[model samples]
Target: MMEISSAFASGFQGFQRASDAVTEATVNINQQAAQSSNQRALETPVESRTGPSMEQSLVTLGSEQINAEANLKSVKTADEMLGSIIDLRV
Candidate 1:
């Protein structure tokens, strides 16, 4: 009986660790996304034939990047929530 309880406890701890790892990874991804956006904001467009202004291009690119980041955050949130639920079950 003691051995069984110990095994169950060990498994639970492992599950908790995995949840923590996922949370860490999600945070890191979010940080990277924010940094990438900042870098994009600082980038200047190369001289080209008259067309859209550099500011306009930057705006469009930034908007697309923001949308992508939002989607990624949503996915990470869902994954974190799922992990929490699983941890609770365990």
Candidate 2:
């Protein structure tokens, strides 16, 4: 029984770590995408009128922000759940 509980705790901890890694990767990807879009807009010829518009970029940024927030919330919730489980065990 003790070994089982220990294994469960380790599993939860591993899950939490994985969640953190995923969240970090997501945020990095979003930042890179925004940067790439902005860079393209700047590099494009003004007369050509090509590349992502400011409005579109803003919308994308907003969505990415929301996504990052959601991921953060997930991490927090997972931490809370792990804590609750430990409390119950004790």
Q: Which is the leading candidate under TM-score?
A: 2
Candidate 2 residue-wise lDDT, 2-88, digit = tens: 554555566556556555655555565566576668878899533433454555555555665565566555556656667787899
The digit string of per-residue lDDT tens for model 1 on 9-60 reads: 5545554554554455455555555655776798844333344444454454
TM-score of 2: 0.48
Location of the lowest summed lDDT over 10 successive residues in candidate 1: 45-54
Q: What does the lDDT read for residue 8 in candidate 2?
A: 55
Scored against the true structure, residue 45 in model 2 reaches a CA lDDT of 34
Task: Give the clashing residue pairs of candidate 2, or none.
Answer: none
Q: Root-mean-square deviation of each candidate, in angstroms? A: 13.8, 8.1
TM-score of 1: 0.46
lDDT top scorer: 2
lDDT (CA) for every model shown?
0.54, 0.59
Stretches of candidate 1 exceeding 4 Å from the true structure:
44-90
